[model samples]
Target: MTGARPRNRKELLAAAAAGLFARDGFHNVGVGDVAAAGGVTASALYRHFQNKQDVLGHVLLTGVDELADRLRAAVSGLADDPGRRLDPLLLAAAEVSVERRELTALWRWQGRHMREADQKDLRTRVGSLLTDWLAGLRALRPGLDPGQTQLLCFATLSVFGSVGDHRATPGAGFAELLARLARAVVGVDLPTARPSSDQWRTRVAPPPSRREELLTAATRLFREHGFHAVSVDDIGAATGIAGPSVYRHFAGKSELLLAASRRMADRLTLGLEDALATATDPADALGRLARSYVDTVLRSDDLIAVYTTELANLPERDGRELRAMQRGYVAEWVRLLRSVSPGLDEAEARVVVHAALTIVNDIPRTARFADRPGLAAELTALTGAVLDAGATQP
Candidate 1:
């Protein structure tokens, strides 16, 4: 069904494609689907974009443009008062979060489908926005080193990005709540030095087997390159085996993805069990959960990345099972959060839990911050702050 014709076909197509790609995933959406959604013919879409990938590039860049313009206007004429700038900046970001709910998802997962040059451009533009934020934050808190300031900026971005992860109806003061949480992240006190004993550095010995090596190699390749971009041959080469040899251990690339995804789910489940078994109370349980999560993500970020972004590539049944497992894990967090703070409703607790987890997942994957000393401790503190702020929301 063709809808009303848009005033500008290009913008309309990009917006339509963004929503579709964000909801259904890039690999699942086709050029005709985008054209129909935009209320235009396929030929007309071709006039604007060369292909589906081109449409995706336009959608992502357009979102980045909106963010840059809005943030620039939000902080206009407030350079002298750097402390006051963050409030309007964050508020503007919150507005984008609500208005363009698909943006974060597009940037996080779908952009991997783009060519490397396009991806680099996207990163550069987004990096400029983050640089602006880092300047403002550094001005307000001069004591923070470069790494700490950058980490805070990334965490703040994650707080706003978390909105796209769920479909729960926002409560009253939703934007205000997000801004407050971002502010809390910005104000977190980071550690000045790495811990004397770095647990993340301790590596386990690799299992001795061809199949295990193939699985390990496949997960990393899938993480580095999107699932559709990698192949059985690529996975085999990484393990010094022929492409056909990969099938001996796994039936196909799909099987490798399913195996890698299940590995991630199993690790998270084990972490939760560990957290539950050791905690004395709900609050303690939540803290242990957060710490366990940070540790898990830090140690196995490639697995986490593959699990999060490659869900669309899994077989239907496996996808459903993994997603259900994910929901159950999140439910446990929500349950513990509500127990810790009886005032928080289920929806509120869920949003808060997502924001906290997003920070943990996102910050450690960031290249600059990933290798920094004391990141785990700082992340745990930031997680606590997010939970504390959400728990006491008035």
Candidate 2:
């Protein structure tokens, strides 16, 4: 089926590869799958990309180029003022959430699996776009330092990327909703003083059972190296066990992933339930939940990372059950937010909830705030700002 025009054929192959990589993990999809998806034979696909890695690099690098180009084009015709230009630039980005959903997801998930040199190239390209955004944002908010500007830019991007990860369709108004939420993220005032860290504590803990030790080791490896890249023996080595000792604790690597993912989900579900018990009202309950989430993420980032990224590697039945539990956790947040903001519809509340969670999830990765004082308070305030932004949408 090698029927595409010579010029368009490469693009068709790249597009097919992006969709396949986004739908299935990059490690899971093979050159044959991409060739099949693009309506071409393996030989034809190779003419465009040297191999599957090459295909991934092409999709990711080009996708980043297009995203930056969209932001640039969004402001090209507008006034030179940064504040005046930001609206259209953001709206254009939000529109991409719908138009280029697969490409967006590819940038977020598949880029992580690239080879070292490819990963460096991808980061450099993404960093350049982020610098451009910071330049404009600094112009608008001269009070913000480069760190704050970078955080805001990444947070805003995360909001748009959330559309690809979820099934929510807020009718046709999703773009506007995303734009509003993103603008709120950008408009947030970063804290100047380092937050107080007295409340943050580390536990001096004892040893765990062999099964628990294996799960812990698996979670860290899966977070660092991806799920498919790590093997049962890798988990065993990480736990100081030899050879097939890992098998006694778990059926296989997938079961270890499922255990780590389910543990994270259960912690979140249980933590929120515990917070709601003593809340004075819905607002307090939401605030408590937000703080608890930030603390948990800050402490167990590896677990959270694996839970977010590696759950798809689980067997279909296990993956389905885990995802159901996750959705229920998010649904609890939706219920609490709706209680606090009665005017927020289900979709609006869900978007805001995700925006808030996105901040918690992405901010810690920056590493700047990982050891900063008042981290929880700052994140909680940012979450509030996102929720407040959603409130003004209607």
Q: Which candidate number maximizes TM-score?
A: 1
> What TM-score quantifies how close candidate 2 is to the native fold?
0.90
Model 2 lDDT tens row, 150-169? 67777787788877666676
Worst 10 residues of 2 by lDDT: 193-202
Which residue pairs collide, candidate 1? none
Give all candidates' CA lDDT scores.
0.84, 0.80
Task: Report the lDDT tens digits of candidate 1 across residue range 1-394.
Answer: 4776556889988889998999898888999999999888899999999999999988888778877887776655444577767788888888788667778778877788887778898888877666667777778888887878878888988999888788655667778778888888988877666665456476587666998888889888988777877889999899998999888899999998998889889999999999999999999999999989888888776899888778878889999999999999999999999998998888888888989999988887778887777878888888998988888866
**Model 2 stretches astray by more than 4 angstroms:** 1-6, 74-80, 192-201, 207-210
Candidate 2 CA-lDDT value: 0.80
Q: Which stretches of candidate 1 lie over 4 Å from their true place?
A: 1-7, 77-79, 204-207
Counting clashing residue pairs in each candidate, in order, gives 0, 2
